[model samples]
Target: MTTAERIAAAPTGTETAGHPGPLAYPAARAAGCPFDPAPAVDHARREQPVTRATLWDGSPCWLVTRHQDVRDVLGDPRFSAEATRPGFPFLTAGLRELITSTSSSLIRMDDPEHARLRRMLTADFMVKKVEAMRPDVQRLADDLVDRMTDGRTSADLVTEFALPLPSLVICLLLGVPYEDHDFFQERSRVLLSLRSAPEEVRTSSDELFDYLVRLAESKQHEPDDGIVSRLVARGELDFEEVANMGRLLLIAGHETTANMTALSTLALLRNPAQLAKLREDPSLIKGAVEELLRYLTIVHNGVSRVATEDVTIGGQTIPAGEGVLCTINTANRDDAVFPGGDTLDVSRDARRHVAFGFGVHQCLGQPLARVELQIAVETLLRRLPGLRLDVPFEDVPFRHDMAIYGVHSLPIAW
Candidate 1:
């Protein structure tokens, strides 16, 4: 059956003959506390770490909420990441349509294919390679701060600093023109929005794919140092394959870091003591970045996988073909791994977070993300010592509607 048909035919509500109704997956976060995982998620982690939950289509899936269990599910090869597989859970119909309609990237593939594609770009994001770019990232951060602060005491950090910093860096890496950022950024927003319809997702994805394909074709004629150019030079991947990889890198490279930058800044602002502590000790920035990643865990919706064979997780046996959602946000808050997990502590040792995920599919660009965030956050604090919210805390618009959680707009004055 088609995805639409499956969703349409799925049972309504979580009611079952002999069991309690499953809690709704992607439960709403409390109004004032945007940083915490949904209370329902936290409660599930504490009370029922492994339990049934209903997706947007009322499809039942296993929700694994504990830290160890989350790692087990993601680490076990028995759980597949292939979205096209039967019973693979998707957060929204639009996402399902988007993934299945497009050529699969590393994130959407399994096994040798995933590893093969991943190895092609592994050198680009290696810790040493990314660290070498730290100077460049630092320079960019300083330049952006200069631009944002020139004759301006206040600015919307999201537009002026947070978004543009990583967008510029990724554009440089991908060889895409920074001038076309508006074109891609708008489309990316739509692609990431849970509220977007399947048609909207399709249109946006198609435009991006076409754009990347054209860019790759251009690179074939006159190559550059960027990733797309290198891939075109290799001659191993066709234009469409290159485009698929490019699309994934381009969207993921910018969006995730941008959100983390803005959200981390907001988080630090909310925790004055933590901010003060970091300012007093510059060396703490690295650990602080890890702590922020752990505390925020911005991939608010859990990662999805389908069990390929019967496997026990958290004392529950998930049969082959069953869907599983690993709530990393709740896992990050698992008290066993992180004591006092909800509170933000810059000095806390939070290096073991699953924020970047776990096992083979762990974020490939994590090294770059860490450097970008470290520079972005540190530069903001150092350059703008007087930074404070321009609007009241209550007036800040949070991105609850989007699949990724962050502040929609962060107005600040220094």
Candidate 2:
């Protein structure tokens, strides 16, 4: 059966073979509206708000769907981010194995350790530090557009422009050679695929891990001006630890921003009036980016956290040792916070979105991401005033099967 059909047929608070079964977590989005959250998720947000759902392993977890409840759960320390904790929810067996078998990054650690590791890279992504890189980011975006459109009327924006921009910037920052992007990008795809086997995830992750380790070790002798070199010079972390941190940065640094760029362009194209507003007033680019982030929350799988202590949320008592999935995509659509939330409005004040997540574990690279999106969307519109999809809207492939939500490839013409 197709994904949408499977989701439709899934037991929602229904009895199955004399046993009650919860609706499936990570439910598929409605087939036609690829940009919105799963229809079941939206129903839960408006109806139950706090209800139980079953994971791939048939494990039951609380699904916190309301706007305030999602924030409360994510912000509360009682909910642990540590993935190895018992009852911790995993969307799929492969993801469970991938995270548990690898060295924990800041995303998977609680306070003290998470704090310590996060501190090492705080200064690098600080507002001022990232702001200083704006000129370079703008130049890179302009240069990419020039090269992409030099003599071409059509191209796959994903490979030609969107993917390369962030990859180039991240390589320069992390000291990884950009020419080797093919190797890492291929592995990253495997790592992010929901259908990848546990062994496939392990092999791909190990390959990337080994590559980062070698790069980190080399930096020890001949240091450069990159984050890895700086970390090795300080000697605060062992080479393996440094590699673990570098691996997270390298994959996350480029993937999220690249997908956002391509997807944002597609969103604006679908909403012509919204795109026209930005073209008329360049100042709206910043807010437009925020609105787009809220409208297309690309983290399709909700954030996972297991409760360390009994907690009451959305009038539901979640006992200690239970797992909770904060449906941020649904929360972003809550009308309580964002009126007319489903529609894309460039003028809307959407800075309150949980797109980068919330609380201490909130994305460490948000400053850099915001700047990159602002420049990317603005530059593209400014340079390609005639930009339009090269194919029918329904023909564009969406990343429904992948962990991240975005277009698989965006073909465009100007």
Candidate 3:
């Protein structure tokens, strides 16, 4: 049966028996509960773990909500990440254009090529490599907190602390100048903003690409320890390829980490008891970071793939060429895997959460992200024991329009 036919036949009402009839994919999170997944997501998880949904382009796609089912689809070789495919489901039109038009990054490519390019940066992100940077991360965190709490009762945490810390780290790693953060961050914002027009996104993306291309070329003459420099010295990839890879690292390394830092802080502040646990025992910092990552699951809109062949996920057989979306927030909150899944429990063992996704395409920079979160969160609370939201909880601006979920500006007082 056609996707439209199946949706028409599926039961639908105020609630559903199984997959509801043509529910919208990328449902909005419930108001006043920014940390939780949309109520519709939980309904789908309970009623129909795998359901069909309509995308922006009017494509019918499988929306997988169950925990294991999400992993199954992500890990399955039959599912392809090729954004250029005709039937591939894209999160936004701007993103679709960017992915199709630009040189393929590690995330956009599959297997052989993906593995080869990813291997180039694997050692840079390995546990030991990331651990070596712990002192640097700690210093950065300390300096950020100092700036925020220095003779001020309140500050915009998003700008002052959350965003810049990660941006600087990624800048150092990618050999991009720290002074250019404002330039790239604005461009990255435009690139990831759901509200950005296709032309705006394209223009910003082109500017960033050209800048990276120039940077990559300069690295050819002056090799350094940064990622772009290393790639230049190796002479494996051409300028376009190196520029594209550097662009991917720069955006991914900062944007996701920045959101997580701010959003996780908001999540913890909302749950004072949980926040108290972390402040009381510094040893829980590592586990608390894991729990926060699982709870917030900031990259809510990113998990997507196109089926290369027919694949059965959560008892539903998706046909070849169909698009599949693994809604990470709902999957992490799966009741089967996490009882009382919505509650914030810092001590809970959340190592199994697919917040970084799963399979061969899983986030390569996860170790670095984790270390940054651990140090950033731990140091923030330790330095500012009096920290709390400066404004009404409902007043804080949330980034619902962005492809990545986070706060736009978090006002806090220490």
Candidate 4:
């Protein structure tokens, strides 16, 4: 078949046969979230849902798609996250090593190691602990709203507020100086921007580590009552481990929350009736948060995993050492799961969605993220009663190529 014919013959909304490889994503024009990933993932799920892909540098990996498949792989102990082992199907040699390193923090660990590190902070992030943060979240939200009405017709909500609120909140939780937060916020933003150079991401990661190293050293001398202080108090976590946790808090705490906040706002604004409904009745804040998380699934490049032993999911076999890519975006929109997958139904029960993920490795900071989002979205509606986009929907900058699916800027006016 001609290359064009091969491309044409490839079915839509399902995975085609054989190993399509990493080139499948089409990075340059890859549409980020708040659009649709289900089509391609659905195609994969229905056909060759579990297939191998050759990395650009020529390593092979499997991409797992179906809902049950993702859960099974993530739930099973055989699918190891220890990329340190040989024959691991890494995206690229450098990234594989970078992602798999023990120094990389909670995201890469598997089983006992993952459980041990995550438990240290899980209690602090529990819903009750996060609920106590409501007042603080409200204050931050109000402050951001207060800043928006000062003669600016439209503001880049992502920067002036969405980004800073979580960054500042996490810093406070870690006892880091608020004044020094811009560096963390900026680097995190840059690191996630799809357009950024690889060196930029590596540098940003290094800068965060450097900052954490200094902060951890200080905590050793004079620890306070934040999460980091607890790690220091136990004297069990090494500087790297503590810094890794700190870095995790800095990156994970803000990046996904920021994207979700902005994307959900954009989604709501596009649907004026919904926006008006939210504005008129702030009681829907909880429902709105779930709907937003479900409909948006802002963290687009769903988590990756590699099988340590052969595993079977949905009647298909994933070889003992192949990578798996879960489509949170696709799974959240599955027609079988969500009756009308494409439509945004705020009133619908979105709890079943996998925005914060599922299984043993679900997000530890989900409660914290919820409070921040609820405050930001609800507060924005109440404060900006006449909020409307200053530019047309198409004019808005959509972040498509990056790992995180979000908007670059949402220009709105009251």
Candidate 5:
């Protein structure tokens, strides 16, 4: 049966119906199942993987939950990512306002503009280039672990090691001084926060833009071996575009990786058997990373898209101008695609997971992110042989209010 038909015929009082409405776009995670997607997401995947949904602004759209359906929506060019589009699904009014008020970056633009701008920065994140930096990444990971474990029986892994590794790496990659990490990190938190006040979001965005503007301009006069300096030297993009690009890279580069580091570590600690297996065989690190990403799928929100043409998928017709929320979290957790999907099995072949997303907009920094995560995970377990959570797993604070999902402060003791 078609997904919509199935949903309509199914029993009532499902989690979807218990909400503000049956089609609420943003669903909440199950109380005890913090790592899994919301019960609503799971319900959708099982009974009606592609069904109608109501966005935050009371706009109706299609919520795609199945793995292949999400792939179809995201990979198809008819679906646009432009935030300025009339029916684009925005998570918050603050985010919509921020996008409209500022110059668009690579994430907001479609190809060939997206391709052109992305081309300017791709060289730095290419697998070979990032692979060559493994020594540096490993060194940084070791140094942070040394500091985190030294003179302290316990540490907030979020701030001590997880947050700093990627922040420092991105700073070096972008030519921004490592000393200014606190400045950007705080502003980024405000910007990514789902609960930030409108004024706070606006101020943080403007401040970040202004900082990038100065940094990009300075690079013109004095070139450095950073991504921003190289883009500035290219001279193809204007000052505003360059600054926006820098802002996008700076915020996105670190935030996602940082969250993954912290969350993945927490997941491992919780799954002691998996942690022991990984510890026993260092060769499993690559597959373990993929499994953790699939299990956590930290980017809780789907990658938003606006339909530009009428399309039919899973027997539901999505008309032009409607929004589509390709719920990645659900797709990754899909039981059909990955057997025993909810359970974390580090040795599973999870290479097909969409944790980095898919299609042309797939994460450009996947290579760098993979390298950093591998090093960080390996170093943490190798260095702190008896690492475990200091606080009760239930007591660990989660970033449910932020666009990215992760632990706020993971207290660790070895």
Candidate 6:
């Protein structure tokens, strides 16, 4: 069956004559599942067209779902990436500070400011620029796999393969000190887990911000040839801004890539024939990755934006100062844009998928990530052709209630 069909075919309650199905669980119950809690949300997005919902923060908000509507909202200046307004997601209070704090980074700003900051970092993530780093990325991927060798096998690929690989590459791009990688990785993971208690999340964010400032200070004199150093060259951003940028990269670059890596592996393992197709024709890897990215929808967390001005989408009026969420997971699965939108079609044309935010604020780390996944997936399949899941399918431990969709540990044995 096609993707949309699969999702449509998946279990949804039937309200038969004189009978009512289960009352819907509140948003906190969203954290109780192993995958994204988007199926219900997507159904609402599609069936009700436009609906009102309570955010995790217990504030009212409008959820946008159809692909065209999502695209329009993303491009609309009214819906800016200011996540601190009323009705922002309550999944993790720490995320408010995490996103809004980057007032200086391109991803967090709008128009001129966002453009200025993005221009500063443009050369580093350009397709040609990242292509040059292809050799280095490949070497890192190969080395990680080489160490994973042993006749008897059980390894947490997230740690041994997926997690470190991106951090190493992103650090290289940003010029972070290698010694501080573990420290940075731990805090990044905790900060991205929205399902955690608020106090713990706040504590981790405080510590991470402090750590980033120190790292930024060290870059002042002994500026290396990296992203921070390049930004330092411009002399436009203040020290705090630089540190915040570092924190942003540390969080966005590593968190999403790691989650998708584990999830993609599961996707491929479940679709062995498609995995073999990718193995035989490495060219298929790129599209396969995009397909997996769209199919997986790793950023299960909704992208919250505040309305700088009044706007209407899908017949609902969002007044000035209201918060709006463009549910990427829901939109990506919308049948309107993606025919068979829910299937994991390795060869599917995912060109229009908005896994990367559209327009000016699209993901800058995309090229680097593409290279990392390209190398990582190709190397893993080539080296461990018989790689299989060690644990029972249902036994896998995953964080269902987090902004990032990922497993606690991706346990596997061949």
2 or 3, which is superior by lDDT?
2
Flag the better candidate by TM-score, 2 or 3: 2
lDDT of 4 by residue, 36-124 (tens): 66344556655666655444455656666666667777677787766665555543333543454336576677868888888888898
Candidate with maximal TM-score = 2
Model 1 collision count: 0
lDDT of 5 by residue, 301-352 (tens): 8898888999987777789999888888889988878998989999999998
| lDDT of candidate model 5 versus the reference | 0.86
Off by over 4 Å in 4: 1-23, 26-34, 52-58, 86-97, 100-102, 193-198
lDDT of 6 by residue, 262-312 (tens): 888977887788888888888898898888878777766566677888888
What TM-score quantifies how close candidate 3 is to the native fold?
0.95
RMSD of each: 4.0, 1.9, 3.5, 3.4, 4.2, 5.3
The number of residue pairs in model 3 that clash at the backbone is 0
Looking at candidate 2, the ten consecutive residues that score lowest on lDDT are 12-21
Across 1-414, the per-residue lDDT of candidate 2 in tens digits comes to: 555676778766546553345668788877789889999889888878888888877899989988899999999999999998998999887898789999887889999899999999999999999999999999999999999999989999999889999999999989999999999999999998899999999999999999999999999889999999999999899999999999999989989999999999999999999999999999998899999999998887889999999899988899999999998899999999999999999999999999888989898999999999999999999999999999999999999878778888999999
Write the number of the candidate with greater TM-score, choosing between 1 and 5: 1
Q: What is the lDDT of residue 54 in candidate 2?
A: 80
Predicted structure 4: lDDT: 0.73
Model 4: pairs clashing at backbone N, Cα or C within 3 Å: 13-42, 13-43, 14-42, 14-43, 14-44, 15-43, 15-44, 32-400
Taking all chains together, each candidate's TM-score versus the true structure is: 0.95, 0.97, 0.95, 0.89, 0.95, 0.88
What is candidate 2's local distance difference test score? 0.91
TM-score of 1: 0.95
